[model samples]
Target: MGTKMIKSSQMNSWRRLDNSARIFPAASSVTTANVFRLSCVLREEVRPEALQQALSDVIHRFPAFNVRLRAGFFWYYFETNPNSPKVSREELYPCAPMNRRENEGFLFRVLYFGNRISLETYHALTDGTGALEFLKDLLCTYLTIVHPNIPLLSGWLDKPASPNAAVLEDGYNKIYKKARGFAPFTRRAYHLHGTPLPFTAIKVVHGVASTQKILAVAREHGVTVTAFLSSVLIWSIWQEELKGRPSWSPVAVSLPVNLRAIFDTNTALNFFECIGVGMQFNRSGITFEEILKVVSGQLAKELIKENLSQRNAYKVRLSRNPILRGFPLFIKNLVLRPSYRMGELTATTALSNLGRVELPKEYAAYAENFEFILSPTESNAIKCAVCSYGDRFTISFSSNIEQYHIQRAFFRYLTALGIELTLETNYFYDNKPVASPKGRKHKQ
Candidate 1:
């Protein structure tokens, strides 16, 4: 990706502005807490060079480097920005590798494996589903190249640049329009406090199961998996509110929805919108099933809402600042930070379901399962990345919040649904290693 250098002046001169340009909530998709997840099954002898090649290949296939937060708004064009700085992984973010440690940059390449690999991303670029699709393709390509013998399962596996193929569904542009986001909110960017909760990967092996089993479990009770999961999380937050001696009385849960379903586009910089769907509940009558029912109702409406698309968010953001394209980012950041915090109130925690990363039928033989890791945000808020691969489910929890109990209680409740879970943690002490994803004996 080249430097994004387009200034507000150059962009504003797009004379054919649509009169139908709409406004939406300032805290729309792109800026509303960036997050992403990557899951792959790696071989034991993965080398850095191999990973670099994999990443480079991945980028070349889908080049949306032109997408960025410039002049306080998101923009996408094949033409590289002449005004933007040359962005290396480290230079692109002001935060440290472990500050809010919030930024999700290029590959960490930390875990080279024995049938295991995982990575995370900042929400600034795209939503959970978007990231999952990219990773699925990346792994599929990497696997085919590395282990050509393993046949891939059937689904839309393909060479994306092909002119005659149905690419990954991205129906957002038809619904949302590009508008300057006048985010009237402020979060201490990458600033965090409180100790991170201790976490580890939980392990369990099982025979492959159909997506029907997973989806059946979710929709059996009339709630989509996304709604059911969010409901469970919201209930957990309320438990934290009551059981823990926290100052806040209510807990929150937030989620990101792909606006592509609402409209369509191909560029993958950042194109989804976010909404926090939570309720303050007393611990007295708390139950995940009950919350699930309620959330199903809310989510049904959210998914169908005409205005929850990217264009709506942009419109809302631009309505707040008509001249948003004219200011420097720091100046815009200064102007917009406070308003962001004000809008951050809808939820305290987030549950990101990357939905299903539909892989082809052939690859399942050796690829094993996939898992997505949720990263800690600059805010001390807790979040989770829920992803399903084959029959197994992986949930990655952010470690920034004060209560680890909420996460523990969350999984405990999930298992009650007849699904087994294994836990794995990803932090380390100075230089000394705690464990590797493949730290155990290789299965299969």
Candidate 2:
């Protein structure tokens, strides 16, 4: 949105992607864009014109987000793109592969339909936390334009003419520590196999529940929120495991940890790492309580600041080595792509919890709830994303596979525990009435 030319001195201000983000570009292809989406569903229909202006205004606030990915000799870096993101109707599905060439070289896009606005971005550009911040500001500006005299949330939206330099920094470098050793090689976890959907179609199923009830259940189990849900997911998959399959493989879940709280950096860039939690079930049959205990203890140990910090720092130190930096882009991709893909072998699926989202009471009237959707990978066919707004918490299950056995099992388990769940989907034919776990389908 800012048309003023960047000064000559600032022309070299293009920043490198953070350590965690460095692999996304090399891993990306026409089939796998490595993109994720954040959506804010509202009570009223969306106004395209006002949304466009709001996007332009918000882009000026978060300048780090206005970037296009460029391939250097050895790495992919972000260059500033002053052009505004095109706001159009929601024609494609959520988390669709993004072709940067179609959007003025920008790695992100904004789309709106009936009553929802979606922000889809290549993971190389930013993480869910940054994308949510941008969405909050955009919503604030759009509401202020459409409804005059709306009270704006001060702390929620960043309004400076330009983002702080710290917001553009590579936090991994700032906190890098020399490598003590390489990461332990994890044995391949069991993969969920199913008939792939035709034409790369992704089926999204959202199950909403009261946050209070869910947390209370977590308290009853004496496990953290993420641990409780993760255990349920593991149980779901374990229930669907085929009889005669290898029994040695463990059920693993990848939990993405946001590093901002640990590192004390506020960059609107990729700043997170994932650690896998897994357990094996015996013939005796594993109970939910046992699974919760395993997930809770594993999560507690892995989330320690020092552990994650040292691991992430080591990765940055290794990537920045002088010798490794000299590899050509093509060769780098050849080596990094398979390595990164193999990392997925450690987990059957991933669960990224964005946690709670807060907004001024005034903004609640315009917005309903927020949904965080994680993109599925070729190896990991299904992934889950979680976010809470007001009293409602939404868990979005996105998968390239057509079956919902895992999702259904997980939701049924929740309902059995007395947590009411309302189901919603993006699939066209799924609109017809279908039997649900409960007597009826609750409103979305």
Candidate 3:
């Protein structure tokens, strides 16, 4: 029997998921969960009742966020969710599946552990940028409720800028240009395959570094922080390969581009795209200078308006095609899932940088750090997320594979460059050192 459609009858409002979000519903599965987490670590322990009340208040301000995913004959859409979000203590690991039944028909879940509050949302609900915006407001509201005496900066805890309609807009529709330029193609890149972790578990390793030190290094190399870090990742992965793969296999890094800055809209919807930075090498290893140069050039080329707009336009076109639009949901699922999986072949792994997060001076003493962790996908075994708050920059690596040589090599490479590092993990035993590519292991 088909599941009953879950929606609020009283609220006659619904929205089509944005262009980038269209595939998440069809592609999501138990092993390959499409989700991301935005977490805030506060100085004070969380109070559940107060946090719940704050969530209630914050939900009203961001209507786009209070949604439930629904299946229709043609496509999936989001309906207004009248039910209150179920708040719970942080349990299980991050990025677990959030099917409607598990999430109370809502697409996002909130959990708190000690002083940290986490907001994990299915990618169909929003991208990292949108999720981060919601997290900021939720944290602001929670702080206000918990510490009434603390003064918030002007409009710090307030709603987004005027025209709330813009907050829910399909930005791709607003900026898509029907050009003959085709969307970029994907070639088969190197894939990280190994023994799977037991219990479908995810292993996370976080390396905290000084933002200033990394920035200085990037500046010295005449590259942005992302280019610098991506170069290091590519180099690290190359080192792990050790000429094991065929000569054609390239070490590619996938990056999520925030379209809000490019597309002139403030919509808290999925307004981003992924571009791959790849480099193939011969039997001889590639130098760090060469990797950085290619990554810098690729990022500079792919992030421009011309490339992003054309890529997104292709997505909008595919979703709006008359014939494709009329296909039943089941057929669409069969078609989309395979295509999405094929697209995953373009990048061996991904790196999403959320940029800097600055809180109000009043709340600085109350907050510790922020993190953005990308859920490991089925095809992509490992992925990285980077974000900075205050002077601390955190690069978190999440993997589903039992072998963590790539991550260990990546962090060790950074420390070798004189960047001080501190490591953290979810599992207590994970604090131990990981085996290196040379069969020697050392703690970070």
Candidate 3: stretches off by over 4 Å: 1-12, 152-154, 158-163, 243-246, 428-444
RMSD, each candidate, Å? 8.7, 4.3, 5.8
Which pairs in model 2 have colliding backbones? none
> Clashing pairs in model 3?
none
List, residue by residue over 334-364, the lDDT tens digit for candidate 1.
5556555554544566667776656666655
* Candidate 1 Cα deviation (angstroms), residue 75: 9.4
Ranking by lDDT: 3, 2, 1
State every prediction's TM-score relative to the real structure: 0.67, 0.92, 0.92
Candidate 2's C-alpha lDDT?
0.81
**Tens digit of per-residue lDDT, candidate 3, span 174-221:** 997887556665788888887777654687878889999989889999
Error of 3 at 318 (Å): 1.3
Q: How many residue pairs clash in each candidate?
A: 63, 0, 0
lDDT by residue (tens digit), candidate 2, 95-134: 7887877788888889887788889888987888888888
Model 2, residue 202: distance off in Å is 0.3
Which segments of candidate 2 are over 4 A away from where they belong? 1-12, 152-158, 179-185, 243-246, 428-431, 434-444
